[model samples]
Target: MSDIRPKYKGSLLRPMKALSFLFREPATLPMEPREASEVYRGFHLNDWEKCIGCGTCGEICDNFAIRMVEIPDLPSDPAKGVKARRPAIDYGRCCWCALCVDICPTGSLSMSREYIHVSRDLDSYLILPDEAGMHGENFLKGWAKSETSDLLDLARQAMGELEPEARSDNFDEVTKGFDAQSALLEASRCIQCGMCHEACPAHMHAPEYIRAIWDGDMERAVEEIYRTNPFPQVCGRICTHRCESACSIGRRGDPVAIRWLKRFAMDQVEPQKVQEIALKNKVSKPTGKKVAVIGAGPAGLTAAFDLAKLGHSVCVYEARPEPGGMMRYGIPEYRLPYDRLDADI
Candidate 1:
């Protein structure tokens, strides 16, 4: 053996060098709760107002720890794409993968910095999070949806349009309808947040119908659209599309082509079948109450349709000789053909 022990050179000073650190301030951290990093994923904190109760988080939860429970007090407007439900998390099974945070349509769900929880009660781990933290301490946000981790398709599928030369020569439909694949792809982009419902004056069931279209259930989609909107054909073509303006996906990307989806649904169903679906819920018995609508525009017609369904007699008075006020007269022929407008009415 080569005398390895003899190779130590000035090693006696190494032990003394360690003592120098002893005189320096000792590394210490306060036991008190400290703020986590800005992007740290901790406990969930949901904004109930912004949450649409779409239950998408539960679906994406690979651990199956999330469940959508109906909170009856919360608004459950199907027409608006809101369910009377919220996510109840079982933390015992949570991996904190943050999938829910990234996929949230409205970005209402986020994680908080404060994550401490110690209790004998097992139920405490099962929480329905709100704006407050796990203990209502209102901890500052940690992890939240960001551009980097966004799961929604931000870019809209470009709809094809006829060239100006091709369109101007004849008053043909300007935008060619979305093919089956295009419609399905567009429908898949919806996160079902229901912001469109809130923004729509007609409160159309955009999410439900959009999902129906994606699921390949055209008739079901037609039915869902008819729930709130009686003139899908006309609205699909020429409505100002306030719903698209409020779409949650629109915040980060092109709002779901909601108007186009509606158009696609209306186009799939035959005029006769659509007429049958629209009148499916009409009351069989006469209510003896009569309603007089001033115009045949979308607003007045929508009200008349509902009233008629509730067993009330509706009499619509249109100033124009043709019933469709703006849809028939105001909108250009290429945008909404007279035949399509007739089919809608």
Candidate 2:
């Protein structure tokens, strides 16, 4: 065996010496720009026709280069989960991470292969994207969000429920609502897209309340719930969450359990506290106007709740003996517990 190791060698040469040739112009090419490949991530090109103006691009921007500016002339349909707002990008501050493109629910935001630009004013760097490219030319598309690079928790957390054998003889709530930890985990799955708000019949603030639940602020969640929904408990149990259908995450995986999260938040808050929160916005002075609401269902009751709060005398009529028309008579006790439903009313 050799007892001695080879002697080490060291060099004093500078690492930049290898790059000295790169500084020299070895090849000649035209100064005119050329088009890039379909995958090239150059400038932004938005399709106004399909854009919903959700401002999700701004929300997901890590550099804060995008801002949602209100354009009055543009369509603002909150019912469809769109706003009259458009994204104004600051090229000077933009990192071009493409997170905005990835987070866009409508798939309207996309990048163009055109990279060349000439501007005299600094304000020109700040631009509002539209169907046309920056120069109003239809440039080829570049980097875009695909299913391969999605950044959302699409898989929903499984919710517990009573089995048929478990509740066969007894009449009890079928669904076992999320616990504290499970509720927080479920709430964290939300991307705050606000699609749920538009798809909901009452335009409930689902994202806000979901975030509140994630932050462990049940009171805040309940307050946000009261912003639109007068019957949180009832809706949590039986309302057909159309928001889930419109969820951006559902494109790939299961949609977030928005309805279950609502139930969890409402369950956390005391019944008295919920009532107090619901009545907090009640009208102090009654108005002379009178409104008659026929049927004590959710629709009529919601109308009455709004009208009554506006200082108007509102009367609600229902065919059933109880106020909760279909919600009470139609829905079974197993599906929607009567105690929770009564608490909501």
Candidate 3:
């Protein structure tokens, strides 16, 4: 390497010439509005046909901006998971996080490219979005599900079960039910929107019970189930679960196996264990009130149970030889066993 002294060979004249172009031309953005990138969060677009009016969006709404409104002309059927009630959003409280869209069971709810909304009247702020755009201009979809970004797990875990080969020969139950790890994984997927509870015929405390199951507390889940339904085994297996239909997670993916989960929790512990846990919250002193219950079906028996638990002497008169009314006679023996029904009684 040779040591060299630098000489001032630099020229300022060449750079001064380049600066003259700045005065000649002004900086400008592209004349046409640029299209938003894919998956860009923007305006609202709700597919009314797909929306079942489950009101799940209203429940998960932290802002209480969403309300369930009854539409008289709309169809309502619990079995198919359709409801007459749709959501009316109050933009004043809506944060536009699009959680409602993410949790929508039907994937009918979405945002659009038309982001601007101007209203002189405050009532216009609270509008129910239909197929038409906000300004009646059908803008293309903006925010939508991408391969990389989805709030839900579309695939449900394959529950452990005795395969058809194994179960074909045996009288034993086919499902093994969820293990501790599997139960926790399944429970973690819930958003706690209470759509399951609303959809349940018995209106079981699904969210609370599911939370308990998630926390690995079978006792708590049993207690919660017993609040609405005394026979967890019966409901766990045979009850038509409308809850799964309204499940927000079901929109993009498989709904949580709420019925199976209830069964899993109930089956983990013995019947005696569940009884003991359930009785912990029982009232010690009697109200000394006597009540006559006409039937012993789920409805009558449930009422009787409540009355009996309240310290009222409840005498149930059944027209049939045994209790459990239709549950015993109507439901198949393989589904809800007589032993489980007897345990609840």
Candidate 4:
């Protein structure tokens, strides 16, 4: 019978076969860094020129990886809602969520395609990113803020008003003002950034009052309104709302109806209640000072209100039958009703 087992013959050339390919070129190409996708969430990039430094990004950061760093050299204009600060990101805690980019009111924050950040220094991980990338290199932007990705409700709640035809005959106010439901909806849109407060000529506590209105506390809203301005009804109806112009939310969408919200709060609370709230902190002891202000316009009345609150004898003199300055005489009755003006006075 033939032997079933095969003869064992070891090849001497097997060990040398592995060395033959060592001199030959590799089949795979050299490993080079590949470009990331267009929308890759990578390192943060901020346009310092466009950034208002509202810190909305830092506030929305769930991981607390962002902080506002004050830069003294940066222009700080509160009336324009610009702060002299910028966001500093701690990459170690950041999850690359791109939420800051989506919620940035000015659309200044974005991510870069270049994500390769290797460093031996621990301080390098926390950086205040600007227009330049991590290494001060110009990189393609990725994961930028788009209309679809914006978290802010840009469109403002439409306010109801009297039709032009319906009010053509009478001198009643044109704007019907915001109702309770509309007021709450409008007030809820405020991010409480205090931009409105800074922008307001009177520096009214708009954020506080708006929050109060959102919380369904009309009295509290009135109290907040009266903290700075003596005439809520007047300003609510006739005064130009510069606060709206400086509103952070207005960067992309219609600004919060600050004027309308103020009107709503004033309308909801009774005049007596507002007076009580306004005078709550008035000085108990009389100052025994006499202040006589000529003209019963807004300016004069405001001065009188302050003087009276300080426990002084205050009197206002007016030439016309009524005193509202341009608010009553110059402005049309359709825009500002006399009754509301009277209530403010």
Q: Which is better, 1 or 4, measured by lDDT?
A: 4
Q: What do the candidate models score in CA lDDT, each in turn?
A: 0.85, 0.82, 0.78, 0.88
Candidate 1 per-residue lDDT over residues 166-278, each given as its tens digit: 98678898988799999988988988766687778878888899999999999999999988778888888878898887676765568899999999988998888888898
Please give each candidate's TM-score.
0.68, 0.72, 0.73, 0.84
Candidate 1, superposed: residue stretches over 4 Å from native:
1-93, 105-150, 287-295, 311-319
What lDDT score goes with residue 313 in model 2? 93
Off by over 4 Å in 2: 1-41, 45-52, 62-64, 67-88, 106-114, 121-143, 146-149, 284-295, 303-321
**How do the residues 82-139 of candidate 3 rate in per-residue lDDT, one tens digit apiece?**
7787788888888878887776667777777766666798997887876675766777
Lowest lDDT sum, 10 consecutive residues, model 1, at 75-84
TM-score of the candidate numbered 2?
0.72
For every candidate, C-alpha RMSD to the true structure in Å? 11.9, 8.4, 8.5, 10.2
Q: What's the lDDT for candidate 2?
A: 0.82
**Candidate 1: C-alpha lDDT:** 0.85
- Model 4 spans > 4 angstroms off: 1-35
